[model samples]
Target: MTPSDDDRTHGGLETVTGAGCDGRDACCRLAAGVDRRRFVQGLAAGAGLLAWRAPRATVAGPFAADDAIDHFVPADKKLAADWVAGLFARGERTWYAGDDLATIGMPVGGVAAGQVYLTGDGRLVYWDVFNSNHNTGYGAVNYQAGRKPTDVVSEGTFTAATAVDQGAAIQVTVHGRTVARTLDGRGFARVRFCGEYPVGRVEYADDALPVAVALEAYSPFIPLCAADSSLPATVLKYTLKNGGDAAAQVTIGAWLQNAVLNDAGPELAGQAERRNRVVQEDRFTAVVGSARPLETAQEKRREPIVIADFEGDGYGQWRVEGEAFGDGPVEGTLEHQQAVSGYQGRRLVNSFQGGDDPQGKLVSPEFVIERPWIGFLIGGGGFADKTCVNLVIDGKPVRTATGKNAELLEVRNWDVAELAGKRARIEIVDAQSGPWGHVNVDQIELRDDPKTDAAIPLRRRRDFGTMAVAVLGGDASAAASIPDGDALEELFAALRGEPVASAEKPLGENLRGAVGRTIELQPGAEATVTFVVAWHMPHNYRENRWVGNYYGKRLASAVDVAAYVAKNFDRLDAETYAWLETYYDS
Candidate 1:
């Protein structure tokens, strides 16, 4: 059987021989049945090599014919042609400049770990490692706009804006003059990029700058070793050569954004409490960034009055209909369902007994709404009224809510203050079928506390993760600040060799910011500045599944990852370069 076009493009098998036939016999039969020249043409076309045509020649091997041109090609010419084509493809991996730059973006993260693209112009872009599907244009905006805590379920729109600019850039100062153009290929006379799989290199040349700058970016990638290869970090090495005759003093500064928790919904984008601070641990210095919860006044609360804990062996009083709710409350996640969380005790109301095909409803006994709030843990389908929990008062639903299409239950509170002292019954409905067609509910309570409550500590409402930028050598001075108008200008000034004081506090909250490092160098000498961007995002969710991350288990935080990488940078870089050397030699 011939493989499909998609299979060919993705390196799938080319052909499968019929049963009971040896490969050589099938090949011989195929060669005998078709004209030699036509077969070659067909083979080329099938291999997606239509641009290159085979030379005119008779079939050359035991099946050679004398009907065509006298030219005789080798029997293994096809294999040789494939090898030559591969070499040509590899040779095409040289520097890409100008128009070719647009095509130079490649993923540089570990397998199954999140990744950021290294663009041709030497900037890191398209950060998708956050475990959430972010919008293509604005990396800060999540595609699922209503997935965040406190967000109302709604469709999201794409904005014509770029991702949260990390300001991941480098600037050089020669003598006392600051170069206007950064190393990201803007305004440079000669800017070229070359991507060799895991490694990407960009070269910048300009007459205005006294030194030529080259930047190599990559994450740790070791063949046959998934553990070492999958570290959540990107290593950037900058090499500067002073080619000027006179002694020229140079200052090199690098900057990066505190992009932790940047993947927020559009409504909450401006409310993220991003924080950045500089930390010195052991011999390494790093700028650590994280997202803190927004500050709000704590409300006075009273103990919740338990309405239904769902801890009993069966539904004692609730009336259950259809096969979806089964005979009683489920012990946990149902068969074939993702892990269920945020539920109290061992059992919860799960309407997925026979998968999503079954539809049913669980009606609670009538109870008095004595408190100002009715809190419950809910998850699953976001079908609104079709698949939701409703507070039925006077035979009508006074309050209703559906899950946000998640398996992880979240605490939701209905403000029943106006309906206080009224009689109501809870109805958990699952009328929809197919994907996310079921519903999960647990720990319904009547409480004066308007906020949602849970038996176990639920996932934090605010995104809390850390990303750090560490300078390899201890000689460089580092600083981190919120990227306000004046702060950015100060950073640029520092990059231009201006004397600036490092932030005394070195800590900022509730703001977007950048971290920078500065270094000084003298002419007639070559120096290399290396920066490591490490992230520790332990929490990752797909739909409602909490997948977590591989690197999160190994390192406690981004600082730890940065420190580990810094301590082993020599070995890692050496092994990577050795592999590159072997590849080129082969």
Candidate 2:
């Protein structure tokens, strides 16, 4: 039963040869070339039911065919899931919010109306504008570079002007902010600029040279609707006109402090293992946040059931890539106190570090996805710790877990009920270069049920929606916040290992902080800095958290957010496209 080429490739859902068969036909096709008894035995074996004496159907939940919400549940869930999965696969973090701000329709999720901070140079220094259903904190706030990288603009001057709606976009104006005499008694060079919101961009110019400098700073994470929730990726783009005769050498850098801000204070900023570690990847510079505990009040004890403690695997339960028997330039080794210290116990550890060239993977055999949670305990650090553990179901990456804690093992888990009743695979990938690049794994667990405890975090609840936006910044040795322009300059230099001539003080004396990066642009060359923030929703917002009168208000707010997205979807789509058309080609 071979399928036609068109039938197999036409629709996005590629069905197996007999997948489209009717119920009776499916049974008949499945039974073909085999006896009924053998087929039944095979099904039993596949479902891990060979030990059971009798067959039984798994009962999941209640259902009402006539109820409107119940009727729409399956369709809505599938639509949302498919949409999210599709966007994630394409490396897109926002919905159909066109490419640019010229987009005609109202944008849905990206940046909302709230308090926005503008740098003296008109750059969007910080913004706390998104709408959050939760009551505690405001939506999301990110400072440019998490701190200032004044070295990027030290040679020139830029001042903030005015913010206005320029018919097609929201433009924040900036002009020359500094005036000083050099040895020859001439004013410092100045540039005119306009920073566009909703577009996540800034455009500036310096036109006195044979090769002029035309800079356009932008981030593609700008959306017409609410952010993607799971991965709120924002990339600030800078295009420099290095087309001039003389090549200009510039340093691009950022100081990052990626901390989860709830209502918690200094603790969140204190426990950072790698405070603004400069991460240089092949394509982009990024700062990863790790060891960020969900609970600031009291540490939650994690006692996950161990699935693979590497105690003994004589049967080869794991698949090793890049080499055989865990030995090579790129391989996973069964280590017993080799590079690091003691293994979790006498059990051998699955240590992975494929040299700087080849990427290594340690994959597990198939397992049932009926469990409510899946996670692993991992610890590693050094020149590179980009190793990531993935949850793959039916050949798709449903969730990912990573570790930046070079010192201690941390518990990382992800919900997997979406793939319940299915078979899934666990894959650990280490496809990066640099020192301390290896990852150590001990207990790999698939939790059977949620933990029962008093004062559970809102995130642990099966129904409450949870999302996070991580802002990456430069290398800050400690938690620091800056306000004045002069201090911002010293902070960048300090991050770059240069000595500060004057006052070296904490940017802010509180718990708030950020991490960042820097980009050096030749006269005509351009660079874009981006980050992705993510969210998870189970349609349990009103079901889990809100119960009484509070639930009513929350439900109303949810409706408003949903309505806003729906109403502006079409308009934002057009507006985004229009804005993209101008910048897309450039």
Candidate 3:
């Protein structure tokens, strides 16, 4: 049989392929967060073949083809976002901004970070850190409201007090007077919430050191409440320059604390199951999740597997929960690029109105897992940094399926042969707290065959198990021994004018909190340390199948970036690093 058509084209280093449809197709859907006008201007500026003085509207030519834009911009070059949505709490009203968080209004009522969605009534729906509504991957959730820690901290040679708010503390001084962070020292510079959902940028700068130092943070914003939205995520971009005659060592530090899945502090042994551990040094991706307790259900015997389908005005034997909706059972599809075909007849969907805080679940009736295949079509989009179709066996999520850029009807079939003779159920989930936090599902079928003819080949599903970080010059032992709890404190303290002491106590999981690496920057010289955060999620079909694919390709994408950086660390300049950091669409 021919290889299944996954509706994708493979192009490695020479020509990168984005998560969207084949780039060659003019009909391919545009990415959710790209600006066409800005793209055109960039092209003209780069080529220098077009006149820049002419107005954009009047200057149309060969490159104006709608499909032409996709050819020029690769997926890796797209404006990446991590947050689903953000707001500046000002006065009595909460003003909405695009991914950039470029809110011009004055913020009030203080900032509290967490996954939040603004409703039609102007009220905000929030799930504080530890709340499992539909988002994952962030621990310190107070950043959304521009909240800062309540302690004094030092970054490099700069010592500053934390803001008593949710957003980051950004203080910029030009000349002699303070120019930015004018709003009560909140350090909020911009909050743009539109276009490719760059999320928003929060900035803090100071002239305390011989060199001017600035910190700009851009959070990812998933469009339309996508579960794929990066939670508690802020890509902190730093800028430092030396103007003094003597060279100096510069240090930078930030506080990142995980509340242990909000399971009531870090002392509990139960925190073990819910523990968040950084998997690697240099490059790292923390595995933060709570596992479901084990439970068993008697296996029902069945010869030829009975099929379950949703057709006409019926949801079949499925029980729906959360915010799922369908007319006359589950029917029809909404406009997303083009008309999405319903599975066979009817389809179930959430966020029909494209509302925010879109979250819900669809559970199927019990059935014997006598076959090696479970097939279905899933389509939907959000900031969806983590949206997924979770296959819950017995009671735990045994497997997960995910798509990108609002992909329509991504066909998938899991190898469930090991579960044969076992009883199971499927949980189609769409728990997104941001905009477009919805899911689309159709044509779910159980088959004895593995659907080898499907678009995505089964054999290509193995994990690479490859992610590593490279540290330059540093005391490896000292760097490794830092404890997570006191790591940030110690680093900040060192920068805050205290002597850098070696921890007398041995290192432990608390090491996750410690900065993975610390390097001394000599006067007029800057140092950068890079590492990979990699975790290979055990295939869901295994016995311990509680891990979800919410991060899906998110962590893997980081792995890819980390790998690139590791290989090209010496060659990568600040300009290239900045481009790659923002280029990532995760």
Candidate 4:
């Protein structure tokens, strides 16, 4: 009789002579039904020392199904063979499509890159693979009432009904109607998912659409092939068969998010340093996502000319309004405020006089711009134009910048080369009256060159490595879309057959966005579209220590990993299929 699905067994043998197990005692235990002397002699004659077989149903224990209490069964309880076989003959288990059980999908990423799950309905979800936390649950921490930790440790799960439109997705346009292969919105009527470790298949069927689509997602897992098995990539192969009679224009699109530095923090909301660009190297075409550090120059030039030192005992030439700024430039930090730094001298503008309830604006005497750059130290709330320093020229603010919710001031430089010799004024406005509704300023200067030691914010760091998604063996045109609100909604517009105006220039930067690739097929034809997702997060953090990943030693970036997978797709695909065939035959 053939072995059932749960009847597979694995065994191995190793030398255990040093563990106080001489050949005599082990042989006697194995030779219970045979002669002890013959068994010991056979061991010396190069016979197998250890062997194991699948457990027989005669020795199986009882199966329990109770919800209120524990279902633990004793080891000595015996069940009949027919009863055990009947459990296997019931049917194959499957996870249905819904928002409640959406997190129970199959993992499709590499070993240490974290988890990226492909749900049963073909939508990619649960993207916790990035270094920052995403979906890992939370636990209680014991702490004093006023000493609670304020740092974010987790981002919680994304399995709600509203999150169904988030992450990567596939859309197929048949004739003029578009159908997202997910269980959300106007989804397919029937969906089936079957997952064997390292290989998963999702089949989609609907009466409204005239095509049948099946997706096979996996990472290479060939036995004894450690190098090929440990790749930091997942291959998504889509097979589509058109069942329509007449010729039909079928458009298939795959979209992915620029999830690098995901969950970093809320401070990175509108930074332009987050980028997604399309690249073509050799035969591989991919869209790489990364967070780049803000550019800085290290050159030394002329010394800065002081604009406003704010060192006098009172407001001499600068005019102050409202109750925010006191009668004069106050000293250091105010009452009920954090210790402030990075300012020169003993006097500076401190707007938190009474509290955050005060609002005011300080206007500087109009001065002709002689230098090419205007530099200043600023700190306070990040309310954009509400709590910021402005460079006003011709009665209009030409440049504006705000603090990053910080107490320590950082140098901010503005390139005012175009405004040189133009009459300009400095405005320190604190028109907000809410939490952190104050502003701080000091040591304003006009310089020939920009400041080189301006501290780069944490959200703009280049710590996050690159991640890429490539369409293997195809020169399909790709586009990157920056979202005004929802990233998936912007991506779906392209999948719904909308013309992308930026398709020719596939390079753009945004905090959150999507990249898409499109291709068309005729009716009654069969086609396979393959996509590979790869990442190169080299650094690993644990126990307050930083280390390097082994995969990073060979692959420098995600584009490199994708290119390697594209070059070896034939060999790796063949070996993976071969292993699966051998296992099913056994």
Candidate 5:
């Protein structure tokens, strides 16, 4: 059947085009276990939910009658096979919450929340925040770069201030903290301030012409990749071959599953084309092609797999963009041997947006959400020396493994948001320097632990969570009481780089020693690194407290050192790891 004009989109689950339901009530029409009475109650007003969209259900899961899957068709296997498949299909709207959304209603789920509906063409999805697919965040975050560009304020003064959309507040950041700075008039506003955070600019509508204050964050157009303080200057390589007789060239770029669920955009009602603001912040494209024909059959069968061109057909179809510094411009050769290289830029601006151009705001890693289980995959692929995957639960650090060393970033079958808490930290320690990217997984099959339904609980916040790293060239500590291994040692060197205060007598000395021996921090012109917590929304005090207990063990020292650190740290009243953001701790 053809997709209707009002069908919701995403997975095969769209709205109910079969009479009675008028495409408008997309939520209440889902085939899932939606309560009919409450469905009507929830559809009281016309909520413009078209503008935003985001995550979950990459592939399909098991089809239990209770699952209430609607309008989903698996070409090769069930939806569960595709890690990023849709849970609720057409008329199967109700789904669980994404990492960003917080828990919606009190005491949700339990077959009584309200009926949710899915759109018709494997598109549009809706669900009760508290219902079966629970947990939710305030709203999806997106690049709001329209009138102006992504900005990062620096530490200097500007001759004048540029006018953005009237009364619109601009996002500003300092160190790692974020805030808002609004324009008073429609034209140039005066200025004499300094600090870095709100970079990016458009032509200032003024006489003095906003030369974009100093450290006042210049780079007029920081790409989205340049905004998130986490992007590292590492190149990823993939290998895709011709699996079919048809000869073809592939255009590749880092794509994101834009999570901002703003029902405000005009494209809200499932459209063949997405016209809303995806903001293409840091969009670079590469083309991969092949001369030899790829025959279809069992040998080359990779399901929903995205590979780089081989023959140099696997590596050829991949696209290459960016000046990429040292290598000048890598058109199509991804040498797994010479992979993990250090950043060659200024390396001091804590975040990506704090730079000159090619800002991080636009350079998001290429992300794809598969069904069955969502794995956070980043960078190129390697078997022995590749990317690192870190896991943080509650406020504690979890262990990472690969059985044998590999050059690929992976987290097998993660069921949770792959430990994407509001406060989880992941670091890449590049010692062996082959390829050291990282990935985040949301679902995982039990490889060792048979505990089928392993749930990472959500509570409040606290000294919050501890930080940890999954080094590409090393291993983690066997036990907190013992020192880290050699693998972790080199890893720390890459992480610590040079001393913070000074190499001669670095400020966080003892702490650095403990961590450095754990993983090395490389020095010189490299990517300026900063610690990051993945958590976004907040739980209640109790929930937050549970999260803190889960990850903070790494923060504690051993024996004598522990005592000294403890005494001094106690002076801060245990608020070490911060749980900032209005969504949480409020």
Candidate 6:
């Protein structure tokens, strides 16, 4: 397996991995809300190398490769949009058009009509969380005839706000790829009938990412619509005024119901499932580096286990609920590059979710808002920062999650389908200043799902009668190398209430109070040195690097990688090979 950008090598065999586009590294160290970043001048220099730039792959447009939609509607007229084709609303619209449409338009009534989408059914349309103007409603009267568009974007025809009272329509259009609405003297002209579709106009800037849609009143850059709004209903009920020669084979799944927006919903439970899918690689390439394999790796060289594929535009939002611990500016992140402590010099551009308005936008799918909090600590160190997470959905933040001193906490709110067209920026900025600095984010998630509830972090377990053993390694041979013979004997003897061997040897820096030392097999060495290894999911996976690989490799004073593992006895057990699917060459 190739070392994907997200790949974070632990010892030798296991590498951390996760979803998201830019970096695939499974961020375990850089906890949620807060991420640690170091300046990597060398990386910046290499990235600047024009010669090193690999040839970018040119993909054929949807039209050239596989044309699916067959029904044709004229382009030069109002388009009859298929059902459930909604705009992330804030006076917004975004039509995914290839170079196929010649023109596109939609008949909008007034500011109220310009909603997230024309809700065919009106059941007090709601947003579970991650407030973005979503859920088109039919109950709200679309146009008041002559009124300005509430969330007006772009100054095109239908360009200005329509007049009030004279009864006119708002014009929607797609000129080339630019989106423009109509505005005239007699209020704007609009069409409102039983059921018609609006033609989608598409454009791309920032690369080939689509920009505007016809029926959409605003861009996906729609603001977070407070689900608890006091304003008049802005129900977007669009009828297909006209359909030129355009084809649409859109599919509207079961009508949007008030999905399970609680903490224990499906999306959250399935969070770890994604890690199961991401097959990571140990780039045996970069010699023992300063940063821990990009923070952490859950499954090493793993292949995807789930089969069903899913996609969407802005539904992939994440929210984590846990308490933040530690005093004095404890750092965090969603997913981050795991660099050693203070290994600064080269700065990797990191996008932080902390700090207010770093001049950033609430991505189409989710609205990002984080508040700093305070919490009590255990066993001393200092006070811990706490946070309650809420994402904007349908223009409102849904769930409230809190966390404590946890790095790279997991958020499972995103379903497989919600991950479509989603992107995230993970950067470590200066934490001294305001929100613009590097704020720690314990967990980052694609928030809008019913399952975000159960995806909480693992709490320490106290009850223990027996222990299991397992190994974490790409190959069984390497895992077999751990000295477990003597350790195993001692553990069994103790369980039977007997004095066992291998109980009083010295512990390595990474080893801590783990089982004890193993007898050596000198030249005439015929000793079975039994050692016990524990295979915790992501945490134990992190330990593999310290004990198995980094024992004598990394600098001292670093994360006594092994000792950290020994500290969490409950989270440890005999090492076990991850029964993950195999990864084939991409």
Tell me the number of clashing residue pairs for each predicted model: 0, 75, 72, 0, 176, 151
lDDT comparing candidate 3 with the true structure? 0.36
| Candidate 2 residue-wise lDDT, 187-233, digit = tens | 11332323333343223332432222222222223244334211122
Residue-level lDDT tens digits of model 1 in 526-556: 6787878777778875554566777778888
Candidate 1 vs candidate 4, TM-score winner: 1
Q: Which stretches of candidate 1 lie over 4 Å from their true place?
A: 1-93, 133-162, 264-272, 299-463, 486-488, 493-524, 542-545
For model 6, how does the per-residue alpha-carbon lDDT over 1-586 read when each residue is reduced to its tens digit? Answer: 1112233221111223575323845422211111011112213544332222111221122232124344343223322232112111111111212211111223321122122222211111111121112222332333323323332222111222211111001212223332222211111122111222221121112211111112212111112422111111121112122222322211100111111112222222322211100111231000010101111234432332221111222113322211121111232222332321211122211223333223222122322322111111111110112123333345444333332122233332323243244332222112122222222222233222222222223221111011111111221111101123333222322222432211111111111111111111122212111111111111112221312112213213112222222232122221100111111000
Which regions in candidate 6 have their CA more than 4 angstroms from the true location? 1-269, 272-432, 436-438, 441-586
Candidate structures ordered by TM-score, highest first: 1, 4, 3, 2, 6, 5
Better model by lDDT, 3 or 5? 3
Clashes of 5: 176
**TM-scores for candidates 1 onward, in order:** 0.57, 0.29, 0.30, 0.52, 0.16, 0.17
Clashing pairs in 4: none
Best of the two (1, 5) by TM-score: 1
lDDT of each: 0.64, 0.35, 0.36, 0.62, 0.21, 0.21
Q: Which ten residues in a row have the lowest lDDT in candidate 2?
A: 164-173
Comparing 2 and 6 on lDDT, the stronger one:
2
User: Candidate 2 at 96: error in angstroms?
Assistant: 34
Q: Quick one: best TM-score, which candidate?
A: 1
**Which residue segments of model 4 deviate by more than 4 Å?**
1-95, 98-101, 133-186, 263-272, 281-283, 296-463, 481-525, 577-586
* Stretches of model 5 off by over 4 angstroms after superposition: 1-191, 194-453, 458-586
> What lDDT, from 0 to 1, does candidate 6 have?
0.21
